[model samples]
Target: MGAATTRATRGRRGLPWLVVGLWVVLLAVAAPFAARLGDVQRDRATDYLPASADSTQVAELQDRLPGGETTELVLVYHRADGLTAADRATAAGQVAAVAHRHTLTGTPRGVPSADGTTLVYPVGSNEPGTDEKKRDAFVADVRRLAHGEGGLTVRAGGPAALATDASGVYASLGGPLLYTTVGVVAVLLVLIYRSPLLWLVPLTVAGLSDFLARAAAYGLNQAFGTTVSGQSAGIMTILVFGAGTDYALLLVARYREELRRHELPHDAMRAALRGCGPAVLASSGTVAAGLLCLLAADLNSSRGMGPLGTVGVLCALAAMLTLLPALLVLLGRRVFWPLVPAHGSTPVARRSLFAAMGSSAGRRPLTVLATGAALLGALALGTLSLPGTLKQLDTFVDRPDSVTAMETVAAAYPERSAQPIEVLTPAARADAALTAVRDTRGVADARRGRTGGGWTEITVTASAPPQSAAETATIEALRHRLPGSHVGGPSAQQLDLRDTDARDRTVVVPLVLLSVLLILAALLRSLVAPLVLVAAVVAVWGAALGLGGLVFGPLFGFHGTDPGLALLSFVFLVALGVDYGIFLMHRMREESLRGSEPAEAALTALRTTGGVIASAGLVLAATFAVLTNMGLVPLVELGFVIAAGVLLDTFLVRTYLVTSASVALGRRVWWPGRLSRAPSAAPRRVPEPVA
Candidate 1:
């Protein structure tokens, strides 16, 4: 008997090392592919467009044109007071130099403003083809030549230049975003654990999970031609750390409790896995399932993000469940030193924060519930204050040279559009298309530009400034008049994006709700409990968006909201917020199963799980908050809203509203499940078993 026991102990001890070794090998194989993920990431507007949109068709046709898509730019030279001969001469000399150096499409001519304060040159080139890198390089070379001298300000602005600026921001996100996220997670972990060694285990495991996710994403991209955008990729990284760390916190908390009763680290870990495994699995599944619904979206960016984000969540789940547990067991009880839970020891009794909260909630459940609901409703009204859909110029938090140039042109050329609307037509109908374009109302001028691939390109300048209502009206007229021709440009793309986002919301929202509710029902085995969680998360999402409206314009000085903001925020908040609900509710169910009274079960569950859930929430919120530092307005908005939503759900909704509602409902909360049946006359406290 003694020999058999010794053999069993040895086998359990060796298991963790074997698992760790396997992970090391897996990572080694994945490292090379993961390193190249950033190379394939694309942030171009056309990359995100719906496949059937006119703008997308134009972009595709342009690739087969004579120039393989034109790289266009406007060189703006300005002086506040007025332009002198020297400034004009300097501008002319620079334009000539640029034309000589690059393969410019036509001889450049400067068009002076009526006020004589600004000079603009429209430059176009097809030499760089459709290669983004080459196009960016060409734009950069042109920018270098167009420089400010003394009073004259020289800037480059156009579709190509703006793309270069946005890409630069996206490219910078890879290194800085990763480093900042890691630093934030590390500091939070240190504070939460307070044990120097204990924090490293989960952090390391999460890092590995992130790397694995990247490799898998890259494979998906290469194998299935999945569109991987900068926005989607960044969000994936955030989830790996934020959601991954959350699962780790819950498991560690349970393991610590198990350690107090179990004699060995291996036994404690096994028991811990059994205790919290279902909840962890269910939570991760809910997140994964919710994200997958995005595949229904018409927007390529949103659709592609679905699978990639799911990969991140699943990888994190795998690592935390397997690798994290193995590491914790291998390190032994000493890993949690300075506050170790020794074998055979019972936890010290104290008045926990959750207990106090539960008491208040139990006393006046309806009142607490009403107040929370009211607050959320009031906050949701703030959505009305949110600005209109964000424009290209206002897309960045920090204005780049391209945005400044475009703004200057818009101010200077109020009567004429600085941006051209591109129309592609069949070569045989080129003359008819040109005639229709000229006859169209609101067109300042229409001219044939390029011919290739059996198609003719016509550039039409609207009488109104770029993106103005008049210009949009003119675009609609052209599309309506010329049925076979495609109308596109930066302005047209934005219009398509907004329309597609509206369509996506109608389709994806209900699917997400259905998916999450089903997962919760299966896990909790109750209809009311699932509905409560779903309803709470839905309220949280609305309130969060409403909060964005209140601050986005007034406090942050943002001019407009991203088109996809509401839908994306709803998906993230509801899916991620339900994570905490699962933790608390699973505990409450366990207590009820052990024969605790309804009110007692709710309070006890909160007391045991509250601290861990709060800590996890803080980590997740802090990690997402890092996105606020990004230069892109969409990223900043997304980060702020999600972070704020998580905090609100954690400290307010989950802690107060959920607890109170559960207490008020009691066993009825679990109606249709066995737990809903009448309880025994006396409560029974199940004794802890020895391992």
Candidate 2:
């Protein structure tokens, strides 16, 4: 018997190393692919658009045209007071030089402002084709050569130049975003554990998970033709660290408790996994399900993000559950250092902060619930203050050269659109399409361009500035009049993005709600409990967006909101906010299963799980908040709202409102489940908890 016990101990000791060895092989396999994820990333506006949109069709047709899509740019030479002959001569000389170097569609033509302050040359090139790198190079060269002498300001602006700047911003996100997120998670872990060695384990595991997630994302792009954008990949990275760290925190907390009761570290790890595994799995499932619901969206960007985001969550979960546990057990309880939990040792007796909060909630459940609901309702009203959909010029937080150039052009050409509106019509009906474009009310000029692949391209300039209501009206009229033609351009693409986002919201929101509701019901086996959770998350989302409205314009100085904010924020807040909900409610239910009455179970669950939830919530919110420091307005807005929402949901909704509601509902909170019928058995004596 002694020999057999020795052998069993040896086997237990060897298991963790085997787990680590397996992960080493998996990591080796994933590393190469992960390095190549950025190579496949596509950041073009057309890449994000639905194939059915008119603008998307025009873009596709242009790619098949005579020169494989045109690279258009506008060179602006302006003097504040007025232009002199030397300035005009300088502009003309620079335009000629540009034409000499690049294969332009026609002779360089300069349009002078009525005030004689600006000389603008519309430059078009087809030599670079639709290759992003080649086009960026071409735009870069033009900017390099087109310099102003003396007081004249020379700037480059147009679709190609704008795209180059946007791509540059996107390309720069991967490194800084990763570094900031890692720093944030590491600090939170250090503070949460207060053990130098202990904080390293989960952070290392999460990094591996993020690397694995990138590899999976690359594979998805290769196999499924998934559109991997810089934004999507950045978002995937955020999920891997944020959600991954969350699971690690919960598991470590449980493992520390088990370390006190069990002698062997391996035994303690196994017991901890069993104790918290269900809640963690259910929490991850809720997030994965909500993300997958985005597959129903018509917007390609949103649809493709669904699978990639899920891959991130699942990878993080896989690493934390397997790799994280193995490493923790292998390191032994000594890894916890000063705060190590010794076998048979009692934890320091102290009241949990959550206990006090839970007590207040239990004493006046209805009043607490009502007050929370009212507060959330009031916050929701702030959405009315949100600015209109963000425009291209206002998209970036830091001013890009193209944005500055465009702003100058908008001021110079106030009465005429600087950007041409492209219309693709059947080659056989070219004349009719041309006629319709010319007859459009807001069109200042209409001209026929290249014809190929059964389509004819017509370039039309709006009498009003680009993206103005007058210009939009003209495009709409052209679309109505020329049914067979596709009206498109930069402005048209923005319009399509807005309309598609609106449509996506109506479809995806309901599906996400249903998916979350169904998953919660399966996990809890209770109708009322699932509804309560779903309602809580929805309220949280509304309040978060309302908070955005209150600050985005007045506080942040943003001119407009990102069109996708409503849907994206809704999905994230509901899914991630429910992550804490699962942690709290699952614990509450566990207490009920142990024969505690609903009210007692609610308070007990909060008192126990609340600290871990708070830690996890803070880590997740901080990781997202790093985006606020990003260069783009959209990233900042998204980060601020999500981070704020997580904090609110963590301290307010999950701790106070949810606990009070559960206390008020009692056993009926588990309606139709066996617990609703009666306590499983006589009330079991509760144990002293580390939390």
Candidate 3:
């Protein structure tokens, strides 16, 4: 039946082939347009925060309060001997001259460090609304002034400087990262398949996935006003490469297996699809759904990444099911060139090591279960002490202009350079709220203004930098002090992050688990199996997190643990982990239906499916581990955690969890439906050895 289906598919492959080509062309047409959507905002951190009272009430409150653009150009003067008073005066004069000439806003105030090694000139923007281009012009003018009358080695470092630096870093890193990912995946394919033709299949499929993903993103952005930034682009690349290749491998491996069954080439392709397609689709669907959960995230960047990653995975699935099979039919028999076919032989019995491991695991399920649990528990201890910092300056390897400017501003005018905190008060109580915030701990100063009718805005400067835990705590405390007034700013953004992290920890895990359990139940048609599978997955997930915390927290200097990592780890472990469980359990059920005793069926299933599981796990683990090469700590931690989680799920969880559950349940494993008990009249031939 499978053979006939494949042959029929081959006869009608032209339509799918055309569809694949059309997708390719569409993607190509959209590529350039997609590439131009860059992060257009300066101070993206500020943008990520909720609208502050000052910004919301700017029009009505403009006249009564100090300008919102309180910050002027920050000046840094340095010499080998440290800045002298004369150098400070000279730098201040230069800053004042530039500010006066440009008629920049706010009084030009000179601030020098206590050590006298740094000085800052705050030249405020001229009007309430200075466009970015005008600010850029002002920055350029300041640079020229600071560098005039002999090379004083003065450099512009502030919000403007940081924006310039971050842009350069993005430009330098973006193209190279994309090229390197492609190059690495290409080289790996060549090494693994050893056939240029076969290698190109995965590369082509990956490219197609990328194109579709981008087009989908463009469509989504156009409709929803959501944009994908350069940072998210890297994530899209990885999702396509790792997931697309994994799906391709499943199809190719199954195709080879069917070929060994003496099936005709076209028939074998269809047979492979029939056997593997369901699993691949299930895996991709779970992953895409898991990623899509990021839409609930408060951060726009994170929320965008969720859909972008999902679209990529979905495209990869489409390519695997439609495009890849068609391509395989076109390249029939030549897919595994230079390797002679091994005819009429089941490859399973010939592998002594795998047979031994399977037999041992099947026999001593308790020992295997206990050992795996212990290993995972040890690793999970690390997660308890995970840090939660997301400061860019702390994370980036090289100081970008923004970070340098921040450091300079910190050194020169610690009090004045503080990020603004906006407090909103009811018009009736505006004066009281402003006075309360001004006296709050860590607040350097505060000023208030009534916008109109029922609201007032108070701008407060903190003694501490925004986004710090201390700053967040201070903001929360101030909010409490004001009673009814709302506090929002960079500090509020931090508060939001803290709240999001808490919600993810408490909510996302349970939701993901429930989703995975529901998926397993539907796939297996057995509540008992899904329950055990989800439990085992949770164990593996905890262990992976605990282990990652130990490795990343204590050994590495990265104190800020990425909040997104936990959610990502949970999704991968549950979704991908369940895949292996399904493969093994499905074979076990088939064996049982053929009249083998539960124990024998379990052994047979393990011997047959264990090798494929291990191989797939290694490929996936390696693919995820490659993310470390991106030189980003978050990526590195994500790579390590995900790879470790998958490894645990594959080796420990699948082997012990599924096998033990099968043993313990025996006939009851298929309870409520008794689906595993379907009898076959024909004698089962010691399970024709796995190839």
Count steric clashes of candidate 3.
13
**True-structure lDDT of candidate 1:** 0.90
Off by over 4 Å in 1: 684-691
The residue ranges of model 2 lying beyond 4 angstroms of the native Cα positions read 679-691
> Residues 243-354, candidate 3, lDDT per residue (tens digit)?
7887887777678788777545666776888887887877787777667766665555566777878887887788777778777767777767865345565654475455
State, as a TM-score between 0 and 1, how close model 3 is to the true structure: 0.84
lDDT of 2 at 310: 95
Better of 1 and 3 by TM-score: 1
Give the range of the ten consecutive residues with the poorest summed lDDT in model 2.
679-688
Give the Å error, residue 375, model 1: 0.8
- Window of ten residues with lowest summed lDDT in model 3: 50-59
Please give the RMSD to the true structure for each candidate, in Å: 2.0, 1.3, 4.8
509 in model 2: Cα distance from truth in Å? 0.7
Better of 1 and 2 by TM-score: 2
Error of 1 at 498 (Å): 0.5
lDDT of 2 by residue, 243-355 (tens): 99999999999999999899989999999999999999999999999999998998888888899999999999999999999999989988999898999998887887988
